[model samples]
Target: MKNSKGGIYKRFVKRPMDFILSLIAIIVLSPIFLIVALLVRTKLGSPVLFKQKRPGLNEEIFMMYKFRTMTDERDENGNLLPDSVRLTRFGKLLRSTSLDELPELLNIIKGDMSIVGPRPQLVRDMVFMNQKQRERHTVLPGLTGWAQVNGRNCVTWEEKLSYDIKYLSNITFLEDWKIIFMTVAKVFKRDGISTEGMDTAEDFGDYLLRIGQIDNRTYIKGLEKSKKIAN
Candidate 1:
């Protein structure tokens, strides 16, 4: 909290650095973006961009964007299929290579996100966070954060949140660049793209309920809140 070296960098340097880096990244990656968009359109069919509402700094709602990775397949009742069912080989490739996350560079440019910080979570999942966990929102969410560079979808929600808090407590330019380089290495290795036997991470609310952090009533309430937001 005090204006230590890390705090000074966060307060004065982080945003401008994020802006410049993200702008340059978007420019450099524009061709990849176009190719991915075309591939998504051809494979997934329409809505090439996956847009979702996520909580940003101070829990403000903002639209997060990614290249669409799943199909619009539905069940007999017309409900959408599960991610495991809809995610194709190409989609999995996109995720494993971190290409799907490219669109978030725009979020960084828009000030809705940072180049490095805590990764954003669903607005619906906010109810599961304790006051300490909620501290992650004190700064902008990121395209890749400490948690992501560490274990990403392989780690438990609690572990990921701990990493996020650790990053927040010691925000420094050197730390961020370290995380960025680590993220690139992890991407190349394709590590922790998803936990074993799962295509995506489990919901935070379900994790909280399983860990007895939140009661059944609270979980239901969170689901209801999520539905209302969707509507």
Candidate 2:
């Protein structure tokens, strides 16, 4: 009827719903959470949780948490190895099974996220978004979302952002529950865990540069903004 964001469910119901569901999930899944934490520590070492600053609602920066999925192994030069190098079999298992994202329930409980919305991206990734694409940040980020269910790491950056924008326009209560169900199916299927031949999805700026959709100077400027936000 209006900008769709004015919908009653989004304005009044979503956050409380997220809070209740996430709290229940944390309680019911406590055993799984503890086991995952211990396994991450035993496999990836200390700091069993992986935390990073992500752009959330209204582009606010908040630390998002996940279980550690990679090692801190550095090289002779004292620089960390590549993700492909540091990510082990166990890490791959966690990623593929989506077990590494368990800690994000805390983010939902803290109201830093929703159970459904655009999945938050790294600040570096957010910097590369144009004004229109950035509208995805108008709502709290989510653990799983339309883009996530549709193609996950399988889709192109453009496609995923399009899905995020599309989701904002369709934020009904039924729509969110539908997405949640679809997400469960996708996770169990472990579909689109990563694009073929890639350890992780390509970063937005890198994708833009590779496809010549953005100039080197523009990407460099985005990098400057990303660095500024991270600090």
Candidate 3:
């Protein structure tokens, strides 16, 4: 297949699919939403939604929502505990079942996300994507994408970026639906929920030790690529 030069038609078709599918999901999944919200409120207390700032397309920051899957348990010094410690059995169920991600339907409706695209990352991770990886943001971030259904958080950052770039080059209506179908299967099987040797996917800071940060050389290289795309 020829590499897609992303354009208005691509974005236009993708957005409507996102909006319609997200709206249907929100409505169809309302029962599960209520159940999770109740469980989270009872088990986790106070705020039911976990809101975090994640970078979307072009490294833009947006608040992403998920069902709160961890507790705010603090230690003697009043500092928060690690994710492993804070993650409870109930939380594990949510994470493994991916029920925690339902609230992101709103993000799709609000235009912060798509049903299929590169998964959004945190500001810290985006900063590390430096210039090269930042190009992944040329399209809306998604609930699921090439990087996600392929290996998800299980893959190394470099591997994930390679998939992201490939998706950028080949995006099409047909390709998006293919990714969506793959995502459904991955979710049902709960594949790649955790990276090897980590409780959850380790933070970017942790991954950097193994893969190295996007240094100045890579940034300049990425800049050239981004310029080529822009032109």
Runs of candidate 3 exceeding 4 Å displacement: 1-9, 210-231
lDDT of 1 by residue, 3-120 (tens): 2334678989999999999999989988999999999999989999999999888777889999999999999999999989999999999999999999999999999999999999
lDDT of each: 0.89, 0.91, 0.81
Per-residue CA lDDT of model 2 for 40-77, tens digit only, reads 88988999999999999898889999999999999999
Return the lDDT, model 1, position 191: 91
Query: How do the residues 1-231 of candidate 3 rate in per-residue lDDT, one tens digit apiece?
Result: 222357664756778878988999999999999989999999999699999887776656788999999999999999999998999999989998889999999999999998888888765555456566677888788898999988998888889988987888777888888998998899899999988777777656446645656455665554464444433
All candidates: CA RMSD (Å): 2.3, 2.0, 6.0
Candidate 2 accuracy as TM-score: 0.96
Find the 10 residues in a row with the least total lDDT in model 3.
222-231
Considering TM-score, where higher is better, how would the candidates rank from best to worst?
A: 2, 1, 3
Q: Could you say which candidate leads in TM-score?
A: 2
Better TM-score candidate (1, 3):
1
* Candidate 1 wrong stretches, greater than 4 Å: 1-6, 211-213, 228-231
Candidate 2: Cα lDDT at 78: 98
TM-score of each: 0.94, 0.96, 0.87
Q: After superposition, how far is residue 115 of candidate 3 from its true place, in Å?
A: 0.6
